[model samples]
Target chain A: MKQQSKARAHTNIALIKYWGKRDNKLFLPMNSSLSLTLDAFYSETSVELSDSFEADSFILNDQPQNSQETAKISHFLDLFRQTAGIKTAAKVVSQNFVPTAAGLASSASAFAALGAAMNHATGLNLDLAELSTYVRRGSGSATRSVYGGFVEWQMGTTSADSLAVEIDDASWDIGMITVAVNTNKKTLSSRDGMKLTVETSAFYPAWLESAAKDLVSIKEAIHKQDFQQLGEITESNGMKMHGTMLGATPPFSYWEALTVEVLTKIREIRRQGWQCYFTMDAGPNVKILCRYSDAEAIQKLLTTAFPDNPVIISKVGSGVKLI
Target chain B: MKQQSKARAHTNIALIKYWGKRDNKLFLPMNSSLSLTLDAFYSETSVELSDSFEADSFILNDQPQNSQETAKISHFLDLFRQTAGIKTAAKVVSQNFVPTAAGLASSASAFAALGAAMNHATGLNLDLAELSTYVRRGSGSATRSVYGGFVEWQMGTTSADSLAVEIDDASWDIGMITVAVNTNKKTLSSRDGMKLTVETSAFYPAWLESAAKDLVSIKEAIHKQDFQQLGEITESNGMKMHGTMLGATPPFSYWEALTVEVLTKIREIRRQGWQCYFTMDAGPNVKILCRYSDAEAIQKLLTTAFPDNPVIISKVGSGVKLI
Candidate 1:
């Protein structure tokens, strides 16, 4: 086995969101989802296996992780050790490149990088498609982080079938700008939110149906290189995901006052002849999808409009790979 | 025909909301809804039928109305004239007691008072239930304003069967507070908004089903005098109504930054052991549902949190009556 192995993976933003899980244990989605991999945010992880280590240890962003956090990483690493027939303990170090207080999605990149580094250290030499299944066990969206540009997480019936596939190279005029609207910790995690929505919300079934249609249409738009269609579908799909949360038994919203303000500003900018659209995840921040040439201008406008908040611009990014 | 008649009607806030409409011309809602009438906001109108007048004229809020506004009143008065078999023109004078730029639903009170005054002036003398059908034609929600306390607009198959029915007198410890967050005119009117939601939103069918179930549950809560259950149903229903709009094609939201801020404050107050909940309409304003005794205290807290916004408290109001 390799002594040490390092890998890096970039984050991806869902256009047709993967909201609910059909199989929680395997992290299988209820519907297929499409996303764009971006250059700004990423996670680089190094894994070292040795006979001298007492137990598995995890260091994240230069800080030692608690037992609970370390256990999660160790449990994930066990899958590799079981396949390779080894009982060696490993020490993992991960550094996240996401902005401070941005509240962005880093778990996708983090788990993807860890999956790549562990695979290399174990000498498994698995293909990217096979590696996605392992990455999904860490986080559902992490499956897509194994590929570059536009990737799709197919909602397969079995664990072996559910895998990420690259759709488009995203080499054209595609760009993203993120507005960090709030720094507070989220009251509800995405996993808990999606579980409540699936169990309680009456609209969850409809959301799944709409998402399936959106995935088909978005893929067509990507093939045609139609930015307008892609933007509209992405914005509408993101809003629909949040909409289901509002119908839960005890309703909740991830949106804050500044989130809505930034959305309104985006619409106003669009009315002024700019081809920009907005999408939000399970948090208060807003992401603008626009033409690559228009990203800098849009970032400047958002920085001026929200002087206290951080504005970030990112273009198309590559897939997970060894250092 | 009588020379003159005057009537007053109080506004009602929906606990279980009416969103999409089934019949656009007759203003029939897709689902039945429940609401409570409040004393703080109302409309009073006087109607005088005369042979000397050649045309119908309308004076609203002590000012002469323009042609477009006068035409709407004339069109409503034509229904009374047609029913009474009279050709005499009527002079309509209306006064609104709502706060300046509060964005409260005044159309319900306005049309209910107009219906009552016209019923008396034209000697139609229709009972309140029969008058509710006429009031619904002017505005869908106005049907519920014909009665005081808790009222339900039952969705009927035809124009004659569809009418407002009083469910409970609401004489318990029921109270409300209005938070006027924004004074700007809404970009999308409720009529257009519902139309788009019904036509474009994939979740519209689910909303209709959920609303029907909510109407049944809320009525049970009202009957049992279960304040907590009633408040929960009301808040959930209102949020679900707004949620449907977010799923529509070319999605939109009636919420503003201040609107969300006020909601956060209300949630914080609830966490501090206050039995207060919130509901919203097709605009940026928010209304609180709480125990009659807690109204004053909640109002004070909201005032301190949002000093620039107007917060008004109100108790249960009576039904439409002659002056």
Candidate 2:
């Protein structure tokens, strides 16, 4: 009756990372990437449109947002309005369980939820693929969050072709453990970082060149349910991403002492015969991939090593859906 | 009457790093590399060749070496004996002002000194070039340390052709600052790490393919005395080297928390318009390269940032020499 809709979308971790953008205007990736949505972190958003509203209003995490923060959402909403051919203003409320811009892929869930809520509220009736194309306009990773479990973001030539595809529901025994380290905003933003690496890093060319090969090999690994091969490739992909950062002109990194200690300990754990692997985004936190049977043990080991930090274990999650 | 010959060799930091081994037996590098010898870290060795000795004995840092370490020296001594046509047990006494096995390039100085001392003590009459070839048999980087300032190691087809040559004395205003983060022995030896990276890293091929190009470019920069080009390539080479480790099967790193902080601060310093850059070895420490004019200011900043760690400043140094 209130012309309102609510939706939730889970976040994801890239097993094969997307580092450089070929087209910043459309957020077109230079390489295809693979990711796994997690059950532990998600975003919920509700949108209401009516003739009674004076102007568009936005709220996040139970707080009113300033124009600067709301500007991005407002711009994204304009696209939905243009499609629906409606002048009515809307009120948007979003809440996130994931840390904002902390490299936990929060925007992936946030915009995925936003896209779903808009679809319901405006009665756009866009399917998942069409919806993914729109969702990616907000955040590149959000496209993958439109689908459940394993997904792949194809580095297509156009926006329509560049949508994500569901790879597997991950019915397998795979799991992930996250080490949430220093929550402080990154000193370097991903936008600036990607640009810096593309423009200045000597290895950026190599990163771009090898990404396709990596995607193909990793997809095969995922298909064969080869946990060792998958884990090894995923770990190497993350390191390659960080390596590009180090080769950036001014050179930057998101790793902390805790990150290195955890990495070293994880290597030791692997030597001890655990099939665990690690990946990191543009933040100091590290996400480890392992078998569900080993998740509890890995979490326990990490908890013991980093007693002061938070260790969260998560399983594969479903796609964005409306409630 | 001591019948001893003393030689001193200064350590060198690689601008174009030597990462992989093509022939492990002869310590042949997969790629040619360039380096700068520094005055701050050097090793001195006194070799006494006498028939009075029952067997070859070695002393390092004023302590008698264990059989394991002494075996390496004994093997190296066999080369000198082969060249001089004599078999004599030698008492090798060595001292280091540099941190051993901690990425400060200590082996470069240690082995270079050993080679020079053996040449003098045994009357091998090996020229500097021949001595460098002998030094490289112990450690690949030792070849570069045999020459002063700007030096290049040729990754040749065989041991006879693979040798180090001096490029320049670097009499210009260049200087290096070392932040010795930790003095502990690394858990993974360089030999093992190189082997693992070679066998496992997906990016190793790229690193090997790019080294010759980097060597040529850095040489041009060195000849022109272009600080920015030299510094940029040096920084990128280190990142590429570290990148191979990340792609290794079990994956490891030498970075710690302090390493990231220092890297970030260094970036901030660069943004403020300083002609300074950074490179790292196989440990948690960092080396900053800058003009001699800015060395003091850079050292002051680092000293203030890391009061607990030792900050050493060094200028271009001479090649290995007998006293």
Candidate 3:
């Protein structure tokens, strides 16, 4: 086996949104979700393919990987190896570029970069669709990291077709300001929350049924370069995801004091006629999607409102590539 | 002024379930729910002509009614007067005969009987449908008490047709055993819970879409006397309702220790091949629906299992009527 090269990848935030899954094992979703890859926040990973080890090894930010953390990674590697007809093991060394404890999409960058690096090492020369399928097996949202600018993870019937595809290059006026509310990991993981929604929530079907329509509308809105349409749909989708969590049998909430604060500030800013909108994942941290020109003013207002917490601003970024 | 006559009423438990309101003023539901009215538990009431006050007065179980509790009843009485073309107001005296903290359908009986007796006193000669419509304006479930034995409150688009109608007389081998858990009023009222579900739950539409199918299946199961089918569907429906509560924005739970205990015991009993099924309402108490012959055995087991608490058993009961 040839010595593997090291690489880095940045995380992306969903603009349309992906919530529930079609297949848990493969991390296949029921509907497509579009996202914008940012240049600033990312994860740096080094993958070395070796024959000495029996199984794959993962080290995140210089820490040794535990069984739980490596489970999804191991599965992804196994799929890639089986597809390539290779029996050798691999070692993954990864570091998140985002601030420690920051509730950001670090996994997106990690899996996306890992998928790209692993493919390069094996010389599979897999297409973007094939690479996305591998990454999705690791994390549902990771598929979006296969491309930079504007990307959409098309939720096809099977994992084979459910790969990330680039939409617009996003070389336009769009920018994102990530307000780091809390650096700590969230109480509810999106994977678990989505599973619970699928298993117990009576409202899961409604989300599944309407998601395609939402995606279509969001795509049209994005094409028109309308911030209001994008913001409204994004906010609605976020609410819908949270709604499913609330409907679980035991009921789980992905909200904190900071979540409320962020929402309040976002609404206040919006009421002031700012072209800024906020979207959150499974954590309290919020990423405001707005025009490049409005990003500075919005960031200023947010910093003033939350004097203690610092917000990170970045322009739309590119997808996985050789560094 | 004439002396008030003593009368009693019983509340019915809706099996099909009612949700969503078309008209807040009329308290009309979007769909009909089926319910059973029990005979052993009821609410007794009496009314008298009073010229000493400008408005009607109410006393519940020897306690003076507060303005908040009287508002709905007062409004209903006003509507009744307008519908019947009555001239004067009357004083209402009510007493509930059902065990107060047993989570029994006391309010159903109380309101149904009140509506019936009030109608009798008014010399309106209104049928059960008219009575149900009048009472439903006060409490949605109260409309089901106008008929006996598997009554369904048809959620007609109009109030005139949205009345409770009898489906079966329940003269078959059916019996119900209610295991008293905690009799305390729920912290989250159904009205508030429903409102929360409507406003916040992302899965609400999904539940709404599938409810009709569930109602149909349960109705068929009941007609076929398939205990397994009935039990399964009933449990699913109950779980769905509870799931919606959990999915509320803030999320709330209804399961108590006793709820768990009763469910455990029911599962244990079911293991022994007794065709017993459990159903619960807004409270922690559980009502077990089973064959008439198994009632005594079920009662004995429940009593022995829960020695600290009282377990009451009752056969299929009749609807509201004059003695």
- The 10-residue segment with the lowest total lDDT in model 2 chain B: B97-106
In model 1, the runs with Cα more than 4 Å from the true position are none
Which candidate, 2 or 3, would have the higher TM-score against the true structure?
2
lDDT tens digits, residue span B112-165, model 3: 878877777776658888788888887888888778777878888787988987
Question: For model 3 chain A, where is the 10-residue window of minimal lDDT?
Answer: A246-255
lDDT of 1 by residue, A1-323 (tens): 33899999999998889898989998999899988898999999999999889899999999999999999999999988999899899999999998666669799999999999999999987899889999999999999999999999998889987999999989988999889998677888889999999999978999999999999999999999999999999999999998898888878899998999899999989988889989888889898899999999888888899999988899988899999
Q: State each model's CA lDDT, in order.
A: 0.91, 0.86, 0.75
Candidate order by TM-score, decreasing, is 1, 2, 3
DockQ, cand. 2:
0.46
Model 2 CA lDDT for position B191: 89
True lDDT of residue A231, candidate 1: 94
Give RMSD to native, each candidate: 1.2, 3.3, 8.4
Interface RMSD for each of the candidates: 0.7, 2.6, 8.4
| Candidate with better DockQ, 1 vs 3 | 1
Candidate 3 reaches a DockQ of: 0.11
List clashing residue pairs in candidate 1. none
Winner of 2 and 3 under DockQ: 2
For model 3, the superposed segments whose C-alpha errors exceed 4 Å read: A4-27, A33-117, A123-130, A138-205, A209-323, B1-4, B50-55, B67-71, B79-84, B98-100, B103-105, B171-188, B195-206, B243-315
Q: Give the winner by lDDT.
A: 1
Per-chain TM-score of chain A in candidate 1 equals 0.98
TM-score of each predicted structure versus truth: 0.98, 0.89, 0.64
Best by DockQ: 1
